[model samples]
Every structure is written in structure tokens, then in C-alpha cells.
Target: MEQMNYSFSVCSSELDYDAYLAFLLENYAHIRLPYPFPVTLSFLASPLLMGEAAFLICNEDNQVIGAFSYIRGTGERQYEDRHIVQIQVACIAEEHRCTRLFLYALQYFTQYLAHGEEQVQEFRFFAPSDDSLRRLFSKISSLTASLETDSGPLDEYRASFSEWQSYASQFRQTALFNS
Candidate 1:
């Protein structure tokens, strides 16, 4: 089957947060915390004041199909001051998960990071142990797994900016051949 193509964008005030919240509740309710939907909307609507931002993957009609949020920060005084991009949450519609949407999202995110004011030294995220997410990420960079937690036994993964570039290159090649 031909995969549906999507355009990427940063969440903006003009976009309908109610629709986004409904979609999230319908598809990723398991990941939701006790926080009210308004809180989530507020966070997404805010500027990148706390070194954080959210991106959306949308269809031609501008309907959001996938979303991910990330936070960047320098380590504490005891640890080396390394720039880190930690993916706080990521979700894609079940149908879109089989497509190249996730890869495209990652590519878009890498480009965003590259053009940002601060240099990103590393990317970090906790992915469920049983999921293929870690494997997909490995295509972009080497990952060292950390101990598991109650949240479906997550494994933390880290990668460098150069690794993201390599992944983007591979994604382009694969996408071209497939097309």
C-alpha cells in the first residue's frame, strides 16, 4: 500500500487544540496522566521558554496525525553540561505507524535542532522495551539501554546529532527507492 504523505509543522495558536486533545484521548489515552487537557494545551501553546517544543505531523487537510514533544536542557552541575534533547511524548495514529511518518517526523526534528540557536549534543528518549521503536532508532544511532521501569519497562536511548544526520540520509535513500 502507498503510504499517506504528511506535512510537518510546529503547533500554533491558530490550530484547534480541542481537536488535538480529542485525538490524543482517543488514540493515546494510555499515556495520559491525570492532568487536565487544558494543561497539555497550555504547554503546547506556550513559547519555547523552557527549552521545549512540540511538533505535529498533519495530513493535507491540516488534521494532525501524529505528535511529539521534546525538551532540551544542559546537565546539572555535578554532571557535564551536555545539551540534551529528550522526547517527552510521541504518538502516531495506528494506521500511520506502518508508514514513513515517524521517520519523517524524526528528520524534521533533526532539521529543527540543526537550525536552532543552541547546538544539540545529544538526543534522549525512553521507549517501551517490547516495541520496535528502539530498533528503528538504532538505524539512526547506537543505543545503550537503561534499567526498566513500571511504564511498560522502558529503555532509554541516546544519540548524537551526527547520528541523526546519518539516519536522515538513510531515510531519504529508503524513501526514494520505495517510491
Candidate 2:
């Protein structure tokens, strides 16, 4: 992402439907996913599962290089919390991974999470329970659960905005940003 002229925008599900769909198709490798690519695509496309906030990270070429989306609230019907969101997806093109692009995009994301319409205070998410990714998030979040799935081991984590800030600050202090 160094010296790259990129743009950041939000995919309003109403107006930018195709944009988000295109990003998902272009980036997802169709491998190691808990559900089939088609199923996942449809689920993301559906209004019921679509996130309230979908951020697109694009390069100078107008191609989506990264995407981070979060649902408005935890999908639990009985548990109502407006300040908490559930991160649905965070994807960065393979070539752009571990680059300054993530660091930059995260700056925008955190700011919005902290002061956007909902003023999200905390978030929770799940990912493949690998040592690499898990270790990174675990440093700033509490591991709430580890579930065995056909695709792989899955882990759930929760973190506050402050905890997320601490995690993001590490990228600024070090040159290495793995996972």
C-alpha cells in the first residue's frame, strides 16, 4: 500500500449492492470456507444477513483491495445491545496483506466505529481458530469460545474499542504485521 493512491468508501447496501457483490466474488478464494462459496455469497447478499456497515478499500485502479463489514447487533434476538456490533468479514487481497493498506484502512474503520451513527463501543467476531490469527486477536480480545467445525476449528472473540486501539497501535510500532 506504500505510495499507492487508494480510496475508502462505504457500500450502502441499497445503492452499492453490486459493488459489495463484486468485491466478494473478486477476493474470496472459494477455499477453506465453512459454507460453499455460493452459499456464503448468497447469505452475504441477502438483506437479513447483510451488515449494516460495509467498508470497501480500493486501489488506484478502482479495484477493491480490502473489505471489512460489521452487523448492527449481535444476532441474538433476546440480547439487545445497540453499542455492540458483530464483525462479519475482514478480507484483504493476498498481495496487499501485511501492508500499510491494512494499517491505513483500519484507521478509518476505528474512527467510524468510535463515532459513526451507532457509535459502536465493542465488537465480537469469529474466525478460523488457527494459532496465527487467533494469537493476534487474542492479545486484544477475550476468547469466548472454540468450536469444532467441518471446515476447521473456529474461535470467537470479544473486544472493546479501547482493546482494539491497543491492537491497532502495535502495527504502528512494528514493521511486522502478520495475519
Candidate 3:
């Protein structure tokens, strides 16, 4: 199969915020409570306002197909001592779920972190303790056992830059062959 090309852009006022918000609502609004409300434009734009970045993934025609956001945490707490980039959310359009678009978005995001100004020491996120998610993330780094938090039971995953590079390389090879 040929590689499916996708483009990524940081959400900015210059782009169509309304369309982006609509796309997010269409794809992710089903996620309820304790999860940050994603149905509103304000909520979707909050990450950009908070000095973090939100990226929109688009296909050849520039249609919004997926998105993700990350924020650098202030190392005030014990668990946050390292320079961490917490992946706030990652959502793909239903039709694009099993496609390489998801992996492409992740690859782009990881490359951004590896080469960007943040110099992130660790990447972190809370995900359900499920086989698929674990398999996907484990490609990049080792994960901690599921731990209970105020929100709910979520497994915490963290990866250093070196670890990410290793995974990125492997992902690239897999993508290359699969393409």
C-alpha cells in the first residue's frame, strides 16, 4: 500500500476554529464526565490559551480528520518533577481509526517534541488499562501499572527522549513496510 499522507497544523486564530470545534464535537463528544468537556470551542481552545499546543490532522483535501493536544506541566508535584509533556487528548475520525493516520499524527507529534524548544524529559498520559492502548503506547515506552486517581482508574505511561526515539524509529520502519 502507498503511504497515506497527512498534514498537521497548530491550531491558531488564523484557521477555521468553528470547523475544528465541530469536527471534535462530532468525533469525541461521546466521552463523558471527568473527561474535559470537548463539545465547546472554548474547551478545545483552552490548551492553546494555556501556553500549550493543539494540532489538527488533515488529509489531502484539508479536511479535518483527527486532532491531539499536549501541555507542559509545571514540576511542582513529586510525579511531575521531570519536564513533562502530558498528552491531553488524541482523537481520530471513525473512518480513519484503523488507518495509518493515527500513527502518522503520533509520529509528527513525537518529532515535534524531540526537535522543538520544550526539551521534554518525559511524556505522560492517563489511559484506560486496555490491551490495544497498552500495545500502542508500549511501542514508544514502558508503562506503569494502573493507578487510581481522583478522576478514575488510569494507567500512567511515561517515556524519556531516548525511549521515544527508539520507538519512533521502529514505528517508521513499520509504517514504511506497511505502506
The estimated TM-scores of all candidates read 0.72, 0.78, 0.75
Q: How should the candidates be ordered by TM-score, best one leading?
A: 2, 3, 1
> Against the true structure, candidate 1 has what lDDT?
0.64
Model 1: which residue pairs collide? none
Candidate 1 error regions (>4 Å): 1-3, 14-21, 29-51, 74-82, 150-152, 173-179
The residue-by-residue lDDT of candidate 2 on 1-179, one tens digit each, is 24767677878655465776677677677323466667666545543354366777788998777776777665575336767877677787777776467666666677666555567678787777678787767666888999887666778888888777666777653322322
**Please, what are the lDDT tens digits per residue for candidate 1 over residues 1-179?**
76576887665554544544556657656444333566545434332445356667788777777777777653453324447776666778776675367677777787777777788888876655644666676766556775644334656678888888676767562232111
Off-target runs (Cα >4 Å) in candidate 3 are 14-17, 29-45, 74-82, 149-152, 171-179
What's the C-alpha lDDT at position 147 in model 1?
Answer: 64
lDDT values, one for every candidate: 0.64, 0.68, 0.67
Lowest-sum lDDT 10-residue window in model 1: 170-179
Q: RMSD to native for every prediction?
A: 5.5, 5.4, 5.0
- How does model 1 score by TM-score? 0.72
Number of the top TM-score candidate: 2
Models ranked on lDDT? 2, 3, 1
What's the distance in Å from true for residue 76, model 2? 2.2
Q: Which pairs clash inside model 2?
A: none
RMSD (Cα, Å) of model 1: 5.5
